[model samples]
Target: MILSAPSKSADAPIPSFDQIPCPILVTDSAGVVQSLNQDLLLLIGSDKERWLTKSMELMFPMASRIFLHTHVWPMIFRDGQVREIRLQLLDSGGNSLPVFVNCQKTSQEGIDRFTWVLFVTIERSRFEQALLESRQRTENISTALTKSEAFIRGVFEATSEGIMVTDSDATIISVNPAFAKLTGYSQEEVIGQNARILKSDRHDADFFLATFEILQKNKIWNGEVWSQRKDGSIFLGQLSISAICDQNDVVLQYVVLCSDITERWDREQLIHQMALHDGLTGLPNRTLLMERLGQIIAKSQRDSRQIALMFLDLDGFKKVNDTLGHSIGDEVLKTVATRLSSLLRNTDTVARLGGDEFVLLLDNPENSEAMAQIGARVISIMNEPMQFDNAEAHIGVSIGIAVFKDRTSSPEALLKRADEAMYAAKAAGKNVYRFAE
Candidate 1:
């Protein structure tokens, strides 16, 4: 009976080997399948009895199929020990699935030598798919972080305003190129240092202490102040500072944005000069001169003081202009203005009321004699000839003096009286001074 189990190693098929849960195949040393379990029918999708008896090589025609015949067969045939291996098994449709297989030889008395068992791997396939998806998500997150960092770097490198990041303790951590250019400090010199290294000392200790105390309570500050540049040149700046905070409401860092306003200050001063002074002769113009005269009139009315207003006109200026052009007239007028201005007190004001006409505002004059003395000094200076571009030009003055008593009420009326006296002086010949009634 055992004679039917063992044979020329190929003819006899193992009996009752077809009912196990794991698929099993019994083959001889020649790699021919002499028998297979019932599970092999499900694994390979084949119910044909002849397939169970076919060679194991016939089930797998892959290039690495030699594993079953070479390493597996030799080990089982020589040592009688089971060998474990990892490989793929081809199904009836030629789709391959990975499996772990074990092969061994049992002494069947007359049975074939090598038998192998294969277990299907359903859970391992799902686990491997999950691992691949996890790795793909991790790679995508890493790429996004890299792109965000590159974009932030470009913003820091390209911005015009100096940018710096400091911790809550005021330690400099990172800075941009504009910060280095603005502060005259290099990155190597500033990083990891306290931010006070850039302090300009423009603000006093108490000023800064009060400012930061307010900021610590409110976390923001915006204002204008003076600052020192790289070469210690003082400049005005508009500054804005803010604090960045975390989710827990703790401050993370401080951000400061500053803009230079020195040019704006210069322009403001220029506008003031243009408004208050004459552009040509650098003297007070009509508008500011009137303001000063109004102030003097008010003061004289209150204090019971004597004041004087003088209106001066160049004699024969029209004839001079007709002969030598307005350029020489301007030089003559400028020369006359300079001569008359030198005779006034510091409290007095000299102004050009426009073309060949000027006004002198004398504050608290002691008497009409003093006013007449000032008028005489002006007349004497005007007698001296002025040097022009081509020749010496002589001019004379007609000065009208108006004396204000304790009750002089209006600057406009005083100016009108002075002008009338000046015209009377002009009527009196050319080089003379007269007082208004």
Candidate 2:
């Protein structure tokens, strides 16, 4: 009937403390080590005999020892526990290791003692610093992007050329002030509208389709286009369209820039006409006549057909210019050109070389008889009287015809042959036709 009966049951297993992975310690109230696990002895490169009965400050750096005395120990005594307290420890080789420590204060045998668990944190500190630096770098990039967008917006607002931005579907998203001025529409009126709002009837469906096809392939289209203003007035502008793509090369937007170029284009047309046509009668001058002659000669050679090149000079043009003044002479010349052009086929061309000399081109002439009939009709038309203001003026024409069969004759040689034949007609009584042999 004694306690010896309870002890006779079985042998209970002893718990193994060395199996714990991290460094663990037992310290008295004064932070003097009473016991340490084998893991801590191995971690600090020290034996248990060297640490027993020694102050735990032996394992801490000078700064961490001061912090332990000043902050960690006081907090542990007051709170009875401390958690995740960061500190540094000195190893046997004097290398400092960052660590996180957790401690619990307990009463054993009426005395205060502490159980400490420590974790190495050098690699974790490095990882935390890397995360902080990554966050800072992302912030810096965001700031830079904001500044870049501000710069782009300033340029968009200040540029002189009209700019319009659209989505991939060609719906307008933004318009600059210059674009509003050019199109007579305010920004509020244009946003969300399709670019077709500015479309003029000048461009057909085929034209737009071809243009868009080229733009899709090349990502740019620059040309003169007819556009309409908000007031329904049509105008010409030099349009430049560009595609905007994302990092993956997907089309995100379209940008249209335009400048009014109508006046400049009209001036260019005027200069072109002045260069190729006579100033008085508005007939094709020598430059244009030669170009037409070369093209017709090529066509006649390809078709194995004939083309007639006629050279004519007014019979008494110099007499009229001297007697009735050059003003009336100009009127007579205009009348002669009109009559000659009216009587010929639409495929024919009549051009003035200068002064009172004229040339005509007729493609696909039938025969000599047909040629003679045309030549006689031109002479008869020229012989008619022309009313020049108050008085009437009469002028006759002497014609020379040069027939081109193939590409064998050059344009200059052909014109020269016609010139020589014209003089022959003037020699043969001054009012008839002569054919170049």
Per candidate, the number of residue pairs that clash is 3, 0
Instruction: Output the TM-score of candidate 2.
Output: 0.77
Q: How would you encode candidate 1's per-residue C-alpha lDDT over 351-391 as one tens digit per residue?
A: 99888888998888888788888889888888887887786
lDDT of 2 by residue, 249-278 (tens): 678999999999888988999999999999
For all predicted structures, in order, the TM-scores are: 0.55, 0.77
Question: All models: lDDT?
Answer: 0.79, 0.88
- After superposing candidate 1, which stretches have Cα over 4 Å from the reference? 1-153, 164-174, 190-219, 243-253, 291-308, 363-368, 402-417, 428-430, 434-437
Top candidate by lDDT: 2
Off by over 4 Å in 2: 1-19, 25-37, 48-82, 103-116, 215-225, 235-252, 255-264, 302-306, 319-339, 342-345, 365-370, 380-395
- In candidate 2, how many Å is residue 170 off? 2.8
